[model samples]
Target: MSDTLIDPPADGPTERPLPLRPALEAVLMVADQPLDSVALATAVGHPVEDVVAALQTLAEQYDEQDRGFELRHVAGGWRYYTREAYAPAVEKFVLEGQQARLTQAALETLAVVAYQQPVSRARVSAVRGVNVDGVMRTLLTRGLVEEAGQDVGTGAHLYRTTGYFLERIGVSSLDELPELAPYLPDMEDLEDELERVGGFQTRPDEQPGDQPGAATPTEETP
Candidate 1:
């Protein structure tokens, strides 16, 4: 990041929030997945129209400056990705060894996305009792899951297993999957459980209350 990007203007109000574009950049820097305009608006305390404009300007500025990364809007949210031209370098650095298999957490996260999608990571986290952002990224990179769209009510980005997932799993379609939904707790009981307890399991990040840096879904994740 450029010093200019990180530093606020000397003339600007010291007590005021970071400017829209820079604030968006700050938030995007740490996000593990795309975040919708509504979520960004909520986080930055900006209107949706302003956030959209700021994102577009940032994207244009990066392209004009020939930066090494790009801002992309996928589904209903936006995220930063290394520019495509730099993919080879990233791949070389990141894929340092022979590819390893997914972790137990990733497998469990995948199962949730496979069966319960189009679902949100928050919900997947609720189901598996751990944050699924990292696992969801792994699945996305592995071509096992993809963004389906946002939830209509909450605007949370939803994910579903991809065609590649079915192919790898030797299933012709989702219809071939086991009937697990039927095994879930009754609807009211499940909501009560989720509301009462975060999930079946939890880590340092999970909690019963609204998740930090998470969109406040009208419904609970668990």
Candidate 2:
């Protein structure tokens, strides 16, 4: 028999499975926030335990090599971050010619709001010892905080950090926020003060005698 080569059938090219480390890297490189092992495993079609081990190994290898960026487990998940030593460089690069960065006062207020969410404007002001109405508006405009709901006891609108805030900080959840000393004012005291102060007082545009849940007068037609 003559040695003849047969042509392959034309349906589609065969797809090869991706290697573990490279596949994980590719998924992580584009991630907008930290990804838990379960998510990474599902994406790579691998076991969760195996993904966890792989991530640990990758982190160790990066550390050994003194890489500028390292794999870090943060916010209950894994993500790559520039080493702390290089933060200044990264900040400079990101802020180059960018003048719209949040001010120091806004950042402090944001921190308080973040740590004490579902909080009222009065509570925030009490904590910071200053009026935060304008700063709160700025945070709202920046999409960092949003109205959670009105306090049942105080009738004051409560605020909480938004998902956009998490994305901006590269955290998966609020639980990942750094721990702080428990020096915040007592919640009970704040509530009591709010109750005594008439709780967020009605907006200035409302009628003097208007009360919450009250019926509004209708216009009369001729």
Top TM-score model: 1
lDDT of 2: 0.72
User: In model 2, what is the error at residue 123, expressed in angstroms?
Assistant: 0.7
Clashes of 1: 1
TM-score of each: 0.58, 0.43
Across residues 60-95, which tens digit of lDDT does each residue of candidate 1 receive?
Answer: 999999899999989778989899999998888656
Clashing pairs in 1: 35-77
TM-score of 2: 0.43
lDDT of 1: 0.70
Model 1 C-alpha RMSD to native: 10.8
CA-only RMSD, every prediction: 10.8, 19.3
